[model samples]
Target: MAMKSSPVVLKTWYVSIACIMLLSALLLFPVRISLASPAVLVVDDDGFASPTDCDGSDPAYSSIQAAIAAAFPGDEIVVCPGVYSEQVTIGRDGLRVRSFDGSAVDGTPDTVIQPGELTPAAVLITANGVVFQGFYIKDATTGTGHAHVHRGVFVQGDNNVILNNKVEGRGTCRFADVGILVRGGGVGNGVAENNLIENNEVTNTCNGIATVSIATNNAAAYTTIKGNTVKNNLGIGIAADRTPSALVGFNEVTENEIGLKYNSDSEKGLPATGTKFRCNDVYGNEIYDAQNIATDNSIMDAEFNWWGSNTGPDPSKISGSVDYVPWLTAPKEEGCPQKGRMTGGGVLRGEVLFINKTKVSATVNFGFEVHCNNEKEPNNLQINWRVGGQTFIFHLTAMNYAACFETAADQGMPPAPFDTHVGSGEGRLKIGPSPWTPATIQWMFVDDGEPGVGKDIFHAVIIADSTSYVISGKISGGNMQAHPDDP
Candidate 1:
């Protein structure tokens, strides 16, 4: 190759070598890149705009349905605080429909949607992965002029979340007026599953929260209904007519004709099996706490629930064969704490005995003796107290559980964190503590983490007089004899 090279040939050769080097470098070291976020559209009812004006700028879209129609998947639609009198149908997936004021608990949600008389629902969701949050859906109309059946919010989709919304149904009509309805039917169309309905206030309707499976084959399963206040309805507070594999927990179902109703006829091949009802305060219903008309051989697991009485739920209240054994004696709300409070004054005595103690953890149990004065027996006496982990407390003669106070790890609370139970008996025993007598309560506690010896504390307060008491004790792998003068 001792020949002389031309200048043009050398220039082309140098460029070719540079291109190969660049390609090798790129293959060896990849560069980091950032993706653009999804678009966010706005809808203001007071604005003068059209469906085409959905760029999330000034003069935003006027109608919610229009913005949803124009938006692509994974877009967000922020609604301004005003009344939108139209039916909104969401058919796009991964869309977030929120109010301008954010969450409903942040303030009074002024983003109200009152559907027109001709509309079937105030808000109808038919798409998957849609989030409808922080809005007031109300005033669904009735009569021959209006739609025969009007719903505040109707969901027929899967993996959707309906949170922090107030749904008040039309008070005029009794039948087919549902506050929030999740229907599952239609062949080839997907059944509603893995959906969440949480932190909502549903009232003044034929049915507060209803999940009906009309299809003969498919069902609405794995739906979670939690942390909702469903009350003052003409019909059932929460109805799971043919919805199986549902988790209904931590709800206040009261002041309705029926607190909770589950009906499934096995002859039709629709059985409401694998339904778990836990930690709910079901009371004040004129008819029953829960009516289970499921004819299937499968039994409904309804345990750890407060049925407004210490003697447990009356067998006459539940219609079908429900396993309500080991029911919660105290109301779920008052006894389950979400925060750790500082020890306070009380006349109660606490004793902790360790069943097993290891370097990693300890298995111990607690005992407390509460002394009451016979002369000062208050007419409506109630006791609220906490021990061990913060989430589960002991409450006597209370209706509901307390709201979650802190994060689970912050308070060292268990997932299902309540253990206290009221005594099962008759007369005053079914209500509250007996006057002038010592009430001794005991519960086992499994302490987690590196534990040598754990100290458990007790805090009790008479709700009527605001009187508080506190006590503490240490637990190790040793038995401590009870005080001779105790009780």
Candidate 2:
């Protein structure tokens, strides 16, 4: 005899069993434990761990990739000073990778990262809010089989920062190599905005510090390159491709095929609208200092920059649609060598005899050298300009020493202080750093092929507070080599 159970009792028993099974599954649940705070991972290629916040594990990571593999978001990795031979990629966001030793003795990091043979890049960032700092990333690998594009540092993520790093190619023979490249492909843009490339030295590559737009993305629109040293690249220094709102300022762009370049060459046909370059020392390029071609008939705003000149940027050194008015009279940042654009210094020796307005005979002789060193001292002058038995004293400073070497053909130049290379100016005289009297100094130097007793020549008109003396003479001896290319 079998007892027939009701549907309600049977359903209650099944529900109880199901509840028990659910409880068992919950007990065996697995979870990924997250660190309470950002952890510091120490990486030393030689496995020596000492200089770090975290105790260098008995055996730290021997390579940078190993440390990154074990890193989580918001973690920091400190690398010891050494040469690392491998390609590195950052996939974790909010992570910072830096050198453990911050003793930047040479303005470059001792922690060097060189791309391995046939690697694509020295370091690549594919995550947002990451920072790569204080590493000398150089292209040292060489091979025949290579990728179409190679770079020292490549950033494809947004809000990433790269500061105080030296990315050099050492004249890499790679088919195409860039020192520091920021780009946005179809999968890369949108979030690929507001990335900063600052205080970096990028040199000796095809291009230095570039923001490129490609594949339905305009990463260049939100790029910023500031306080960077971009120089000696094979191609362009600070190239912006189809950048619409990019800002480039306080950068040194020099000694390349082209200095600062912006153009409208993108798949989206975006013009360089609202792009501006300010406070940059742009000069010494082989071809063009700045080249802009706005396809949309918009003016490329490239004003307020020091283009190696005080009068203006060289017209022939620039081409295309660029607005270069209102340029900086001197280098925006100090310590840059803007030697030729305004004034020049030389070691001069001359003697002249003239008759004063009182019909008195006066003899003047001077033998001195002027050097403008913007490092320790801004300028240096130690000269005795003799007028008869007294020395001609000017109540001014070494900065007022505006001398230039030009040809006899004034070359359609402006007059007085306006003629930079012609070297003529007037200033008040100072007695030992104190304003004493006013004076006007007008002088000229002409290089007659070489320096000799009667070859190169000079002339001067000295107007003192009470007396005026006019003198002319030829270089008796010494050197009058005027460098329009040094500080």
| TM-score (C-alpha, index-matched) for candidate 1 | 0.60
Give one digit per residue, the lDDT tens place, for model 2 in 1-487.
9999999999999999999997765443311136554877778877756444434444466789888888888888888888888889898889999887542325547888876642446898888899898898877655555655678888888889888888878575346678888876533543366788878988888888888765445354567787799888988898877775566877989998999988774345666544567668899999999987656556667866788888878999998988887676777644223244332223334335443544333433443233322122333332335444555544224332232322232323222211212222344544454455666554445444343345555555556665665556655654344443444
RMSD of 1: 17.1
Best by TM-score: 1
**Candidates' C-alpha lDDT:** 0.60, 0.65
Candidate 2 ranges beyond 4 A from true positions: 1-34, 51-57, 102-105, 117-119, 170-174, 186-191, 265-269, 334-487
- Once fitted onto the true fold, the runs of candidate 1 whose alpha carbons sit more than 4 angstroms away are 1-37, 48-57, 105-107, 140-143, 314-316, 336-487
Each candidate structure's count of clashing pairs: 14, 4
The TM-scores, one per candidate, come to 0.60, 0.59
Candidate 1, residue 319: how far the Cα is off, in Å = 3.2
Model 2 TM-score, all chains together: 0.59
Q: Candidate 2 — what's its lDDT?
A: 0.65
C-alpha positional error of residue 425 in candidate 1 after TM-score superposition, expressed in Å: 36
Q: Count residue pairs with overlapping backbones in model 1.
A: 14
Best by lDDT: 2
